[model samples]
Target: MNGTGNIVALKPFPDAARLELDDAQLRTNLRRATHTIRDKRLRVVGEVDDWEQLRLSGAAIKDDVLARLPELLERFEEAATKAGAVVHWARDSAEACEIVTALVKETAAREVVKVKSMATQEIGLNEALEAAGIAATETDLAELIVQLAEDTPSHILVPAIHYNRSQIREIFLSKMPGVTRGLTDEPRALAEAARKHLRAKFLTATVGISGANFAIADTGTLVVVESEGNGRMCLTLPQTLISVVGIEKILPDFSSLDVFLQLLPRSSTGERMNPYTSMWTGVTPGDGPQTTHIVLIDNGRTATLSDEVGRQALRCIRCSACLNVCPVYERVGGHAYGSVYPGPIGAILSPQMTGDGANKTLPYASTLCGACFDACPVRINIPEVLVHLRQKGPKSRAEHAAFASISWIMRDRRRYAAALRAARRGSAPLRGRGPLRRLPWPASAWTVSRDLPLPPKESFREWWAKR
Candidate 1:
């Protein structure tokens, strides 16, 4: 959702994907980045002797959380309140944004520093804050790059994964104010430039906005795992901190962090452990934020939770492993999906979380490759959920009529034989050849990158009768 109660999609997947496929640079960047991460993840994941068992444990813990979501949310609110953090519940993205905007206004701060937050992005919090005349500065290096370039994130973990070093250097030189001339495209140089740009914002901003990787119900703690120190700065430096988290991100207790912390870093950044792991419970007197607020955002998660089969998507940990391993995402990149979340996980979760309007096409974005399922640290059966969403989703009149016709023809033996006879005659020109390079209108979409198997000259029924 785009924080306005709207399902955000500029166009269907096929249309956006077609445009993205034509971008040679995007395809090249995605191929290189995803493969590098995929190889590294495989190497690190191989180092764990009990990886599969850990995945099972993670999935079980998440399932239990989903099953007991309501109870846990109340428990979390009570604990956070007791710990001096005000807890607010938002029924949707609009309400969440409203609550956060009001909270920032109360701090009387016209500017806010932000950590890398998928939840905020999902609800368009930056735009909301911008409308309120509050400037939200992204402190994370990749997020800063994306913000400077005025682009949406294409990858979950790495917001600027679509850009190469040279591209980033160009963005910083042009968009980042006061950048020195002749800046190099070296990784260290780009990082140093970003660090300098964000350091001032971190020190001056009074309010910070963030999303949690996990929210522990037992202690009302929020956990953020990151490779850079930016998250730490955002968490501690601000006087007023407001965290907007999804309800599904909640876990039963602090112990559950044992399994997820191990799973998240390995799957996301391909590290055995993140460089920085920050956990905050309510307000810590004179330590972190003096005033703390936790906004628990439902934002259609309850609807997603209502679906028996689709609810499995709630088990996601935002690791981005599914994206790195997905062939379709590798080709099209994240912008084509047109959501804050993208890749295989987005293919299923987007439709369910926002309902099957513009995002219904996402369910069909995959080749049904099981790589995403295999790569998921929590073992969320993504392929199964994709198929389930498609089966239960809307269909165009043409698709409905075509299926109806096929079913009618198949129901009668005589009609079925006649259909096969017509098919052989219709396919006669291509019968002796290899896979057809192209087909007519509706089937043309399928044959664009693939070849269809030519129909046989004779039906099996006809051959049997003749023999």
Candidate 2:
């Protein structure tokens, strides 16, 4: 996958948010799902005595990897080539998509079974493959649900978190081929329904596509951490396997992986350890896939790396811990962000990826609440980055006017006092109504979800001068 998918083409965040806010059912689902995960994460994370230290270690390791990415990439290529895997480099999303599509065509296979890969989604790989007349099937349960419904993923870990069991059952019964009648919304029933649908694709697929959780540079072993067994199936069953990974995913060695292995599961799924962890070092001849290919994608990562303050976003493990604890996410949910990556991480990461173009409003989507920073396992200061991006963002005419007005007023004490008296008179109508629920055009946007406080009867300056 590549950078194209991350370049969101939707309404500005506030405009999109207006539609999402009216959906009461989405709010209930988001609140319930986020709270459940947040509770479980607290329980599992508390079990580790040195969780804070582990976070620090994780941050330090990623920092080292980013610092030495070029050298490590060279080292990783050498080891992977020796291990019999072909390595490809792509400077951007278009190049990455071309490389993967050509590789799939080389095998003469029309269908590829895909493990759940955010990297592929970021590049819009499925759409690319479909355009090239190759079918890419999503094998993960939640991902399959999203694909079948033709809907975008709403969460990182659980992509279909927006859908309840009933919604999922409907999607399956309507879209899933060969789905049996009388299918129930029961959890077991849903799993069996999806399993039956994907099983045929798994057996007949000749090519497999995946994204690595971590790539060890010294040994060239690519790691995929997953709860379901589907990732293992996709990694092994196919004759040709291709893994697309971001350049930032590489780590120096196995020792660094030890810290992340512990940090990832507890933060992502609230498990002490993942149910399945698939690691392979290139081609193993008759053991697994005979041919393996690795495409390391730069996309916009180099540009993101250039920003010292924004570079901290690269430390993310895609844990969704920040998403679970975010107040804004809990209220409006992921789709409103209009990026594959939503919530706090998306707020900072998306703008960095595409710059302040279509995604400029993303940085201002937050309330500057520090919850995301606190929930981050790697301790990325997300709020700090958000503020940094906002300062860097282009200012609107209204904002410039407002700031200019305040600046001018503050330059003179008499002007400030006169402004305060005018505000008191203007707010007198609001006193009878307690707080202003709605205001005029420019200020109406702010009052849509909030109310302005009533001004005091007399100015503090007036009372002080009289006293």
Candidate 3:
């Protein structure tokens, strides 16, 4: 994972152009994945009579935690250290990468097995490790697929949701050694092949790197919740375990853990309870890892927190429920967002963390339909934040100058009416059943997809006056 600042600097234009061309395949993959998870989520959530109340509680708890993040982080550091875990604080991505790289180098390990950790992806840890001549293997199934394909994750929970079965089979045949050449697109065959490939790495690796779903400040316990048992294996099998987590992931106590444990699984994978929920407080004698280190990263999170409207994005648990429900994401897919965090969350989050320059186009990608807000378990008001970012966009000096000229012409009734009349006249040559056939430059981008309505023969004000 690269820093949010650098990662967000790479916007959707180049990626989106490619994704839009793959519309059919994206639709098929998104329809299959989203429909399955959406149905499961609704069923499990409906089982709880007070689902709305639980959502409210989750939102309130996160808000309270964010309000006191600095204090809670200090408390977490104290507690973790007391439990024999070395705590490292990183102010940015470069520092975090440097710390992790140095630690891995100290162990003199060339290869490390990894559990699926979004924090690692957020910082481009694998790439950083590779740059330092260390090999980081992703053991999680979806993450493995992503790594093998040399593609970025499309969804938070299901990194390969954009890939169909055939695509996956092709990836395996090309990447995995000893994989059956005649593999079909069956789920069982694919899973078996991945299992076989990862087993060797698990047994041989001396060090493991992971990201925690939550870090408890009270007892200094780190929690990882997952559907697969791979995380459990990675945490325990290695002599050295390094967990890199976002500063925002800290919870006040085990009591607070009860709320997230219940909410996260159901919201994310639509599971009643996660199959593997691993919790460890430092290191145990002759058990798991003899050495444990926790790296708390604050890469762009503090900057995002400084903005009142954007702060709510920090509460995201990466459930990706919002992603599954997002219409734009369903169509364009995650790669188009050009960030580790994609979909609805990425749209608002990327621009704010990176600032509104070229990346400013992301927030405008959505229709502001508020579907993401409804689907988010923590109740992040995505639509509000998106609109807030849009307001920030036109205020840029370059943007203001462009719109300012247009504003001047549209200010007076006569000038506006004349402009509309001119538009109607110009569109005469493009007369069709619907609207104008073609538009100029940047505006043509919008017209390429759907027809732009031509100006009416008369303004509404003129009709009203006549009446």
Off by over 4 Å in 1: 1-7, 411-418, 439-450, 459-467
Q: Candidate 1 or 3, higher TM-score?
A: 1
What does the lDDT come to for candidate 2?
0.90
C-alpha RMSD of candidate 1:
2.2
The candidate maximizing lDDT is 2
- Which prediction has more favorable lDDT, 1 or 3? 1
Off by over 4 Å in 3: 1-6, 9-11, 394-433, 441-451, 455-467
Ranking by lDDT: 2, 1, 3
Clash list (residue pairs), candidate 3: 1-123, 1-124, 1-125, 2-123, 2-124
Residue 62 of model 2 has an lDDT of: 94
Model 3 per-residue lDDT tens digits across residues 234-343: 99999999999999998888898767887888899998888989999998888899889999998878878888988899899999999988888877778788777788
Candidate 2 stretches with Cα past 4 Å from truth are 411-415, 425-432, 458-467
1 or 2, greater by lDDT:
2
TM-score of 3: 0.90
lDDT by residue (1-467, candidate 2, tens digit) is: 22456557377998888899999999998999999999999999999999999999999999999999999999999999999999999887788899999999999999999999988888889999999999999999999999999999999999999988999999998999888679999989999988888888888889999999999999999999998789989999999999999999999998997799999999999889989999999888789899999999987778789889999999988899999999999988889988888999998888788763468899988999899998899999999999999988899898889999999999999999888889988777767778888889888967987988877898777889899
lDDT of each: 0.89, 0.90, 0.85
